[model samples]
Target: MTVSFTETEAFKTFFYAGEIRLLYFLMILMAIDIFTGLAKALKNNKLWSRKSLFGYARKLLIFCIIVLANIIDQILGTHGGILFVTIFFYIANEGLSIIENCAEMGVLVPQEIADKLAVIKNEKGTSVTTEIKEEFTSSHSRDLEGDTAEVKIKIEKD
Candidate 1:
């Protein structure tokens, strides 16, 4: 006896009608970008219109690029593997950009993690054992006193 299971309605809903996990993550990223941009503007006491515009443009471009890639994949009759690869590359790039933008707002990201990501971007491939080594080292080790990251803020008094 053979059992055949087709894609569920729930999966189809997420892929087309609803939000996929990556899309939800991207939405969170967008919120962070907007909040950080607003915080920076307020901190500097500057009423810059470009900041919001820039953040919006980034979000729009990311979505547009992903959609375009999906369209191309459909035309070429390629499975979503190609689209997923494109999404992965863009996700990493956008993640890096988000970190940089947050850093600009005085939210410091861990140096070691950032450096590791930079290395990954540059390096070819890591051996299985090497991946474990990369995960253990962190510049913000102190922040993870127990198991969670505790962000420290140094406020200036006028």
Candidate 2:
């Protein structure tokens, strides 16, 4: 007996929203992030088996969320908006983590480059990927101020 094409897992996955290249890039970034994180942890003598398992589980959950976002996009008759946004968010998040891991490993990353990666976003009222690129480019030269905390003191003398 022969199974129909629609009855195959490949067909179902192929119909998921978003371009294949985006998914490929996400996978690459995730792998890099995991590797760097492990290296950093090992360097600090803080590597734990349970923490590694948790990291794997987190990556699995990310893929599941992307699938759900793709389904939502299909239900809304849209072309990969949810999928794109979800993937973009993860990519930026993982990229930032990878950068931090590198820093922890004693790799020097320029402040401007780190700042650019931190500001990568898919803002409302703009093209998804385009806005991310634009923001990264523009944020590089922008100064980011540190948040300030206020302290109060009261003294009474009689």
Candidate 3:
């Protein structure tokens, strides 16, 4: 029998009251964050495709997390409480990031934001990968335990 998606329980659950709205709101926040981030990057002349790629990857991960939350809610019969909380958490995080980006664009920024921007300017991007790469390459490669990444990259042909 050919089945239509709208005839399925999954479709009903997917369109459950308020859940789709929350999802749309989260999407809107994510888009706004990207827009503000791009504006900030342009203002600072710091545009990079790598950063944009990572940003989209992070947004995808956010959606995955929310979907996981919804799955949990279904399993536990909490009626989407966990999913709503997950969505709201991302909303707040995205909102704060938008504020920070606006601050970089020279909006009415707070002193704390100004101080943070100053620090960011002096320091390179603060991704953990960047930090670890710097740690292994810098003169200060040795950690407190005198440890450093010692392996070199090589490919062995099969």
Candidate 4:
């Protein structure tokens, strides 16, 4: 029998939250962030094994969070509402970190992206990734104390 649709495939249902494309995007962002972060650390001559492991662990934690969100969706039958929310938040968080990393590495990140990242970073309050990045690359980090507009990104990684 010819297969009609794989939307309900067990593999996709178990591994993905809602849409496979969204998970793909999230995975791409995670990979980009990881590589850029490693590059930034290498350029700064400050690659620590512990921090690197923690970074990888944190990435693993993303999957754990997704699983929890997926379970919640299954229980509540919310149709991936929780999962989508969780994934979208992570995307923004990772995107902001990536932009910051690229800019700090002197990659000439456009002002529009820099400005937008600042907005998102402000929203993604007290990110561990941001803290670690700042810890290693404070020399090039910009001051955010003067921004008037406020955006609060609620990431519960602590």
**Model 3 weakest lDDT span, ten residues long:** 121-130
Q: Is candidate 1 or candidate 3 better by lDDT?
A: 3
Q: lDDT of each prediction vs. the true structure?
A: 0.60, 0.73, 0.72, 0.78
Per-residue lDDT of candidate 1, residues 1-158 (tens digit): 65323245543322322225666676776677567667766887874675456557767877777777766666576767656777777666557656655655677679986565456543555433235434444544555677866799999999
Highest-scoring model, TM-score = 4
Candidate 2 ranges beyond 4 A from true positions: 1-15, 114-158
lDDT of 4 by residue, 1-158 (tens): 57534355664456564877787898999999989999999999989887788788889999888878887787788988889999999998888878888887899988888676566455556445566756654353445545589789998986
lDDT of 1 at 89: 75
Write the residue-wise lDDT of candidate 3 on 8-105 in tens digits. Answer: 78854553323566778888989999999899889889898876786788789887787677677777888768877888899987877787678758
Q: What is the C-alpha RMSD of each candidate to the true structure, in Å?
A: 19.2, 13.4, 10.7, 10.6
TM-score, cand. 3: 0.64
10 residues in a row with least lDDT, candidate 4: 136-145
lDDT of candidate 2 over 1-158, digit per residue (tens): 99966557564454445666887888999999989988988898989776677678879888888888877877786676777888899998888778767865879889897566445533553234334434544354363346567899999999
**Candidate 3 RMSD computed on C-alpha atoms after optimal superposition onto the true structure:** 10.7
lDDT (Cα) of model 4: 0.78
TM-score of 1: 0.53
lDDT of 1: 0.60
In terms of lDDT, the poorest run of 10 residues in model 2 is 121-130
Q: For candidate 1, list the clashing residue pairs, or say none.
A: none
Q: Which segments of candidate 1 are over 4 A away from where they belong?
A: 1-19, 114-158
Candidate 2 residue-wise lDDT at 92: 87
Q: Which model, 2 or 4, shows the larger TM-score? A: 4
